[model samples]
Target: MTNAEHISEIATLDNVVSPDKVRLLQLLQTQKAAFLAEPYPSYRSRIDDLKRLKAAILASKETLLSALEKDFHYRSHDESLLGDIFSSLSSIDYATKHLRQWMKPQKRHVGVVFQPAKAEVLYQPRGVVGIISPWNYPVFLTIGPLVAAIAAGNRAMIKVSEFTPHTNTVLRHLLGEVFSQDKVCVVHGETDVAQAFSSLPFDHLLFTGSTQVGRHVMKAASENLVSVTLELGGKSPVIIDNNISLDAAVSRFIYGKTMNAGQTCVAPDYIYCPKNRVDELVDAIKTRYLAMYPSIDGCNKRTRVINHRQYTRLQGYLEEASNLGANVIPLGDVASDETSCFMPLTLITGADQSMAVMREEIFGPILPIVAYDNIEQVIASINENSRPLGLYIQSHDKAFQNKVLRETHAGGVCINDAAFHVVVDDLPFGGIGESGMGSYHGVEGFRTFSHAKSLFKRGRICFSDMLFPPYGKKIHDLFYRFFIR
Candidate 1:
């Protein structure tokens, strides 16, 4: 079927949005009340919840893939399964396995001055978390945070991207089958609805999208004093050491940049290649992409840009870069088919920051290559941009990897690899500066959604009365003499 036909098949699914602002507010209020009713869910209950979620996701796998295909025009089932479906299931399993320990109160040591008192930290759920997910990986982004919230025993209301309404519809049905609206609600809406969602009072808000929109979400959340976890995107870069083989680097790098047609947030936005090996690197990328898919046509592996708006935006980047005399090389045997909104993997060599492709996050199948003479120059250039979500070092030299890891700042780092750290489940995934703020995955995710409440109890032997006086006395003097120094 053609991409447009697939979109037309699911066109009716887009109408599943909340009717008005009142309904959106009502959903939040309902979730808040539900959270208040069951403020702390037991470990066993949370495990059961996670199990049910996992099962439902598995059952709805095909439906979700179809909806995503309709939404993106040509996303492969494997892409959705690996990134959204299986990844979400993995998160649920990880959370389920650890919830027992995560829910336990941690004992803390008391100071000598504060002796005879017991202290512990209780993980309390932050009520009514708001999850604003993006279109790029809608299911995983929404469900990922929801997993953390559920693990922490918090209710959540999700505001999904309008660009993926078909997927939103599938999610709404799936989550609704497992949870009441009060516990977990999927909210789909337009711009005004999104504005209202961002403005609502939430205990915590987690937004995943561009840095520009994150600023707005943060600002709107500030009015309610809502603590936020902003998973924003930036220009993530890869540095290939001069000592490394270009083929080895290409093998590791191509997987990340081409996966999901390079519509990944942590996809290598740009690469730092050895100055003498730029052409070789470009050829390696093209050869590797073709090896993955011989031709864009007839192969179902290709994914299209979400819509006309994004297609136009990405096209403008290529157009502007080409106009500036940059070499815009399109890989594969076939040229991009605009009718399907499909753009083949293209590389922009000798691209500087003057081009929009380099300046902005290229959330498409476009990579810009920066040839570097020295490692320090690459580090300096990366520093000039805002911190990225992920930094990749495609080098075997431990010293080189350590130097880059020690000096550069990013949300996460993958040595001799790229972008796969997000699926590790145990590790915390997030960004720094423009990339994002705060992380959520496994134990870190559980903690992000939970409030660590400190509990202290006094022992029977209370000696504080002796030191309570209007002025300094013998007991106060004794206390001061023993501890003041």
Candidate 2:
């Protein structure tokens, strides 16, 4: 179809839903029946599905970007291309390349007594998988997990966040062109609908969002004993070592924090820097931010906050910190107008545990800088809280980098950079304590949606029969004595 026709189709689909629990069940049942009909899809079939998804993404790239812009009012085009489009396409490509090896049955060792038998593990699909994606980076978060589910030879039902309604419409249209409803479907709804979607008896469920809502998802999933892979957000910390250059550290920090206006789940939540270098670090960040985004008043490249509610929440964080006697610093001279939901890159100094900004996940363009007297203090401070989804450390010194990495815990880490570790296809991306649980990326993702079923086959001559219990004979006694010792 033509581009205009596709756009018209998406606009028609935009008014399609009101978040009915009944529809969620119908979709689940449809996918479950389809999965049962072909429980173990061939490797070639799985590869074909993945290739189709990749093609769909490529074909709908411009439409997806436009929808994202409509949803956020003024989302950065480069951010959408790099973070969402590029990442999803990369994941599909990586999965397709390695799927043949992943689908192969792994040969295992047979014990001495069972020598006549052969053992191996078969990877089987886990039927219908449920995916709950958040609004921030909507396309990537939704499609990323769907790629894993498809790679594992399973059908999926995705529930996109209501906050990004326009993007959801585009996703519905894009996925509809690529997949049958029974094979892959996308649902759009509000909080109540999300709760209903979570409670479904899915073979596996994957959720990506805030820690607060993650708890609710887990609670609802428990009723069906559904396995979950939660990619939740927390206070991801960045440590600037005393030995590193302030300019180098701040440059990396600005890229991570300013991307999506700090709406990233793995975005640097706060900074732990030496007490003396706080001013220098802050100044460097300010200078770098302005160089990139000279004026946020009408800059198209600069992403705005998702909406007024989120914008107000971030503004409240700044106001609360200010009221509590913290030094609130704006990074640029640009003033944000209310119509655009624009929030400038800001710095909160003298921030302590008591301040809301420090206590909560700052999912906006607000950075809190906490001073540390020593390296030991930084380690102690990090350990005291829930492990974050990601940790960033900047230092040319190997010892300092190694020390920070070894002492602290996080789902992922980027040494000398920030938030880039997640895009690496080789690494398994996930969270530890509260940030999240379970991982999905590369081989880890393939295994997450598959069941490793152990298989044993007996030969013509079964050696195990010799040890079958009748009455203990002299040969059995000898065998037991030799093996037990």
Candidate 3:
């Protein structure tokens, strides 16, 4: 079926969102507000709900894997189970274990001037949230935010990507089996329906996708002035300093770049290495790729581009690089058939900033090498473009790593690793500037969907009478002593 037809089929599954479901969500929000008013539910309850979600996912693992494989013809079952299923399940477990302390009201000290008043931060759910997930890593992208929204005690509407119709259908079915549609409803539609979905004045909206589309989603939400958390993509860089262990650096670098066929937001789009060490890193990466996927021609674990559209797009970048005098090195042998399911793992060297491969995000099994003579030049080059979602550095030297960390302004950084930074539940995951805005995951995720209301309880002291009179020396002195310190 055509993409549009598939989207229409899914949207027609349930012609209209039931009014009863909407009312149920409203009632849940009211109940949550009441619960917040009184003694809040112990963190244990929130954690338990996460546990339930995890159990539901685990029970449906096989079903989900099959659906995803069918959706993306070349998706690796093992890769899906590990990258998407395992990571999301682990995140849920982590959030469940740590959610109690995260939900507690944090006390903020009132200044000496406001002696009698006590101030504290009360985190309250922002009614209902809308989560719009992308096709890449469909399982994690959908459930990860749902875990946080549930933990924050907010009702959520999840919009599954239309590109992956099989996965979206399976997800809607699985979620329906696990929870009431009112609490968490999974909607599937095309770009137009998605545009309509974003226009809804949700309490908060969390969107994970490309930077260009993220802007449009934000604009749609602007009509409602709805708060948004965007996890967008950019040309995330991996910098290899001269002082690191080449062996470890190469392994992590290739592993990250090739995982999921480079369809990751945090994938190292390109690398900036010293001119002297450029050849060494390149050779190491090539050697590692051969060893890992011995026969890339029919490697089951090596995923393919999702569809012809993506394949064509990536092919265009490769063609542009070649036409622009960039050296395109095909690391693995391409299958005999030009339109075969597998595309060869590629690495381009002697690539300049002007080349399409280096200028745009190559979301495929392609890595570009850009050599730099000076560290300062590399840093300046990175800073010149839009801030990326992630910046990875491989340097055993503490000082050099610190310099990159401090100098670069990315959404997140990993000292000696690549995409693993997002695995940490405590740290926030999102982008900055053109990459994205706002963050989510763990406590940050909860906060993204919540309003941190500041509550102050003041006793009736009537000390302001001293300032009621017109400006005078005595009144000024009283004001200075009582308020201005």
> What TM-scores do the predictions have?
0.94, 0.94, 0.89
- Rank candidates, lDDT, best first: 2, 1, 3
TM-score quality measure for candidate 3:
0.89
User: Would you list the clashing residue pairs of candidate 2?
Assistant: none
Q: Judging by lDDT, tell me the better candidate of 1 and 3.
A: 1
Error of 2 at 303 (Å): 0.5
lDDT of 2 by residue, 1-485 (tens): 63234323433454454347557776777887788789998988988888888898999999999999999998988999999999999999999999999999999998887787889999999989999999999999999899999999999999999999989998999899889999999987777788878977789999999888999999988976899999999999999999889998988777988999999999999999899999998889888988888764445567889999999899899889999999999877776656899888889999888888998999999999999899999999899999999999988889888998899998999987899888999899999989999999899999999999999998688656677778587769989788988
TM-score of 1: 0.94
lDDT of each: 0.87, 0.88, 0.79
The C-alpha stretches of model 2 lying farther than 4 A from their native spots are 1-19, 296-298
Candidate with top lDDT is 2
Worst 10 residues of 3 by lDDT: 2-11
Question: What clash pairs does model 3 have?
Answer: none
Q: What is the lDDT of residue 33 in candidate 3?
A: 42
Q: Model 1 clash tally?
A: 0
Task: Indicate whether candidate 2 or candidate 3 has the larger lDDT.
Answer: 2
How good is model 2 by TM-score? 0.94
The 10-residue segment of model 1 with minimum total lDDT is 3-12
